[model samples]
Target: MDMAKDLRGRKALTARPLRLAAATATAGLLLTLAACQDGGADRADDGQASIVAPGRPGEKSRTLTPEQAAKAKPDDSPNAADQSYVQRMIEHHRQALTMSALAPERAAADPVKRLAERISAAQKPEIGAMQKWLALHPAPTAGSGTTAPGHGHDHDHGSMPGMATEQQLKELADARGADFDRLFLKLMTAHHEGALTMAGEALAGGNNPAVEEMANEVVATQSAEIHRMRAMG
Candidate 1:
């Protein structure tokens, strides 16, 4: 009976170790599974998406993750395209204002004068906005020289599409009554069209959200004006 009891005790000891090892293995497996589940949940929480852009010939494609493409803060710096667009547009609008100023005294038609008034009202505020944007941004030295208020006269009129030549401006300044009305309509129509072209370019190339919004506004407002001008003629 003593031998039998000793044998039973040894067997019990061996079985206890095996049971403990089994429990340890089971716990380890559960922990591993839990870690994997947590990792998946974290990735889901990140809310990141990806975009793949096609590469040029012989080049690898690029991917933009959500973190990279996320909307920028308002104070984010402007790009070259944004600066150029703002500067050029400010000058463009200034010239339009100059032409519009003439309408009160020179234009014969009420509709023409009203159109001029609308153009002036719209562009003056836009010029101010662009000026403020430029003040905040402060372009590089090369681009900076062009940004002075009322300094648009220094620009080469030939470079800007639809800009009135010095001679044409002189003629507009000299003309009166019906001639002035006709000339103003033609010149303003072309000017607005040029503005549309510039705004479209800015929208395509500019990275700044504020500049893009302004460019879009320019496109919409000037498009409507263009239609009105066409109808008036």
Candidate 2:
């Protein structure tokens, strides 16, 4: 009788922890899902989905190729805007990785650091993909590599919205504690906004599938993140 009672007691002990664990897991799942849902999507004043996030005061659209520089229609040919978007986005994405790499040291909190790291991780591969596309469709230089239009950009400004200006980056480098947090949020927010601008233009004008895919991704992810950052603030 004692042995049977001991066995039953052990089963009860094991079952109790399992039951508690299940309940805890369920609660956690509910909370996480709730957070995701509450984050919500951005809508314009007119109720359109805001593909571009909110911007700071200094935002500007980087110049694109003019119409005369473009290919003769889209029938089996890449256009000038398409080529410029790919090349510039590749450069733009590289800068994102650069900024993301600095986030942990500059971030004020675990969440900010993680978000920056995530952005960096996601953009690195995209940089490589864009480079690959360019390699396959070489800029029409001395005619060696595959040729594309508007092969040269005069400024290479890295002009996207969320991008850290040299001065802002310096501020980020010098910041610590809450200062770091605020600067990071402000800088990254602007950086993301700039990417959204580029993406929006691409969606409206570019014809490449890869270009469209990256543009859509930028819109969706940045839109969600803008809300998350706003909530965090």
Candidate 3:
């Protein structure tokens, strides 16, 4: 009886290890299957492939998904109103720069000279920005060849409102001392008003977001400058 008991005890111990091993293997397999299912779900949630899209000629490239690309609008292709604003504003800003350039020699008051400098500084950068925008979307007049560097086009200068006539510019150029200051302020104020008019038109009719942003900036800055120039006078 004792020998039979020992054999049965050993057999029970051996069977216990086999059962534990089987349970551990089953648990491991279940855990592996669970992990695989979670990984598959994660992949499904983020399955869209990334693609690089080209921007406007001078602009940086952007990344988008297939869905985003499908919904995206082509804002870079400028409309007729946008092109008109750019072309006209370029000439307008150039004339302002011409007026501002006379300030150092012609303006008598220190404040007037400083104001002219400020105007020149502000408009130069804006002119460059507009020119760059134009370069990206060339005008119909622009041949297949590269567009010229500055606002050197043959557009009619008198067509824009608030521009000083040739007689007025000549008068401003010839004036001196306190006379120059008063005339400078007056002419610049008129020029700024014209810019406001153009900007308002752009806001109403222009289609490009960039042009609209520029117009809004012109309205704000030129409006403030107009008030300041009036106060100076």
Candidate 4:
């Protein structure tokens, strides 16, 4: 009986280390997960944030200090070009919405009405996105020869490419039936062309990835719509 008791005690002692090793591993895993949740960075015992920068292909990732991470970060901040593009595009889209609004009441062709609906549906959400982006990343204070990027603050809508003249808009508003259909298709086609030009300029000058993505979407969507309009015409 004493021998059996001694063996049992040995087994318990052997299991303790295994259980302790498992607990330590679990704690380490939890710490690693906590670090990942904290923005791909880990906090040291001293409470300093440490960045985990991934290396090139076939290379191992290494830790970096905050200063190093900042230095390594790409210069993707929104520039004046980005701000201007977004601000102007918002106005541009509003004009498109205005034209589209007229279609439901005046358009004679089913295709024209459908096209107008599509334009409104696509552009409204885009306007919301751009507005949200602008709100999130406010423009810098105005300086010499520059204006703050606010709605209608400094931009002249008439001067923007593809914007219909006030006379043209008035004409569109007055027209009905086939006249409205012809005019809407013509004006929207031109407006989309203008959007393409603006997007190209943004792609060339803007530094922010968000601006680039928005510009690319404009180019792609407008280009397709332009083709469809041409075929319709």
Tell me, by TM-score, which candidate is best: 4
Model 3: CA > 4 A from native: 1-76, 141-155
Q: What's the lDDT for all of these models?
A: 0.70, 0.61, 0.72, 0.78
In model 2, the clashing pairs are 138-146, 161-190, 161-194, 162-190, 162-191, 163-191
Q: Whose TM-score is higher: candidate 2's or candidate 4's?
A: 4
Q: Candidate 1 on 25-73: residue-level lDDT in tens? A: 4444444435545663223235643433334458684444434423211
For model 4 the local lDDT of residue 196 reads 81
Please tell me which model should have the higher TM-score, number 1 or number 2: 1
Instruction: Indicate whether candidate 1 or candidate 4 has the larger lDDT.
Output: 4
Ranking by lDDT: 4, 3, 1, 2
Candidate 1 Cα lDDT to native: 0.70
Q: What ranges in model 4 sit over 4 Å off? A: 1-66, 144-152
Backbone clash count for every predicted candidate, in the order shown: 0, 6, 0, 0
lDDT of 3 by residue, 121-227 (tens): 89999999999998887776555343343333665679787899999999999999899999999999989888877776665655566887787678767877887
**TM-score of the candidate numbered 1?**
0.63
lDDT score, candidate 2, position 184: 73
TM-scores of the models, in the given order?
0.63, 0.60, 0.66, 0.71
Tens-digit per-residue lDDT, 65-115, candidate 2: 223112212232455556777777777777667766776766768888888
Q: Which segments of candidate 2 are over 4 A away from where they belong?
A: 1-76, 142-151
